[model samples]
Target: MTSAASKTFVRRLGVLLGAAGLAAPLTVAMGATAQAATSACTAGTGPYQAKAERFLGRTVDGKQSAADCRAIRDFQLDHGISPAIGYAGPVTWAVMDLVSQQRAAGDNPNAAGRCPVNKGRIACVDLTRQLTWIQDGKRLKSGPVPIRSGRDGYETRTGLKKIYWRSIDHWSTLYEVRMPYSQFFDGGQAFHSIDGSVWSAPGSHGCVNMRRADARSYWSLLKNGDDVYVYGRKPGT
Candidate 1:
């Protein structure tokens, strides 16, 4: 991006959200009820849950509707935070600002005991944490972003691989789904953007799903032959 564009992007990101709720990018099922929403937002305080709910345009009772959780995932994706698996994790919690939490507490620059991959400018995918980030050595370049990988039977592959190809606008032949900003590393699995609703559940056939914004950022930072280290085990793996 040009300097002017970068500045414009930052400025856009800096824009504070108004009192109005965030528009749902994808359609949310009307299945969410007050009780169900309340239970979903049970991760924390009423105020915080309310924040997430209101942000998602759900009931202000701090209930987490299916749509609310999915909307949070969308927010995470847009901000480049990862395991786009929808849950109010540290990053999400902090972003919601409903509670007082340390944002830097769990950051594993070294990736610690998980699948620690020390490579120059690598995209580290921690399936265990459901997070992905780009790093140059120990320096984080892009994110420790949340991501959603393949589900139980269709778990994402672990170990080292290299980016072999990239498609800015690609379509999955088998699944016939739109995979925007795809960066293929493993055979069929790549880092790509998925629909907002996809993050509400443990899903994906066998790929890492990022937010379209994050995928675009990854496209800008990564290239063919770039080291792609996917490690740790997906939940329940």
Candidate 2:
């Protein structure tokens, strides 16, 4: 073979080797991710293992299993729980418990009559259940949706209040955060949308933190002077 042709062949071989080297790591990374997703399930039993098992309709054994981990992890991921490794920790159980409460509410969240039916076109917030809904007399207008209310020390004030102000693009000066679809009902407290998951531990500062869709719907359904009845104590507060 000619010297020039030999040199060209060597250059092509070098390029092929380099490309294979790069492809090898990429293939390994993809495989690792897939393996981690399936194999990262915790083997040790979580504190709420039995409760989680019961909730998920798995065998009532408190011990953790690969199956249990997969089931719990799926639930955690579905609820936006972070580090969703399938551990039945307090946070996971708390969310599951909340789901149970919401299911019990069914079609009539106001069946208990805790929220006064006399008020027309009012928004009712049940802090205990971490749920909120809008009602026009006896008619359910929207949600028994999950909410993240004031955490511990910053408990949301309970009482009958009215939305006195609204800012679609509100930027909080005190907290230095964006509070989208803000509807202020009491003091600095308001119904607002947060970027994070509502089920996140502890809770919000003092406002009713809702998902983006829920906040938008609330903004459209409610207006200034709309009655907002905030009652019941939030679990931790």
Candidate 3:
């Protein structure tokens, strides 16, 4: 399979989890409570047993609701951490610690260079820890920012692509673009921050979501005719 296709499969199979409270991106369905709604933030867990049972394609009963599962996922995503599918692993814990440090720092050190491609610069989305910047010939730091991505079918398109144009302080995204520029692909997709809720649940209509602070930063730093790249979850559980 192609690398992108492979990555998608891996992400699906892996069943990566997020923190228990902070939301990022990723639709979650536990036992019965499946619905999409933004609400007050607090903190929490999904039914591990239910998740495992579902993995086997078997039905199971539980106290965990779809909201619970989504909340947990959102927590992880917003925090730049990943959850363990079955048992807690070292990597999961490490990601938690790293995410905590990053959140505390409140600055994206990764943005200190050029964009991954030779054309533009790089920026880090503090919310999801996903990087987006201009990629022309190399990577550079456009600015420090925050972002969230897809929960399901409309997962953010990653890898190398050129920025079609720019939209400063846009209503949807701080910056917008047309990527891949391939056949039958809609070029209106954009990269910006979230304006509604902080929960990282699966949301957005095919755009890369970010925090307003980060989005504004990107708006002020990046120029038109740059490149952008984003990296996120992959398949294989």
Question: Who wins the lDDT comparison?
Answer: 2
- Relative to the unseen true structure, what is the C-alpha lDDT of residue 147 in candidate 3, on a scale of 0 to 100? 41
| Model 2 spans > 4 angstroms off | 1-39, 80-83
* Candidate maximizing TM-score: 2
lDDT of 3: 0.43
lDDT (Cα, tens digit) per residue for candidate 1, span 61-135:
655556666676667666545544355555465444411121242465444734343567789887766678887
Displacement of the residue 8 alpha carbon in candidate 1, Å:
52
Looking at candidate 3, what is the lDDT of residue 99? 41
Task: Count steric clashes of candidate 3.
Answer: 47
lDDT of 3 by residue, 159-235 (tens): 55545666553442333532221111126556665655323344455566656665666566555554455554522
In order, what is each prediction's RMSD in angstroms?
A: 14.2, 10.3, 14.8
Q: Assess the local accuracy of residue 233 in candidate 1 as a C-alpha lDDT between 0 and 100.
A: 76
Q: For model 2, how many clashes?
A: 0
How much is 143 displaced in model 2, in angstroms? Answer: 1.1
Please give the CA lDDT of all the candidate structures: 0.67, 0.86, 0.43
lDDT: worst 10-residue window of model 1: 18-27
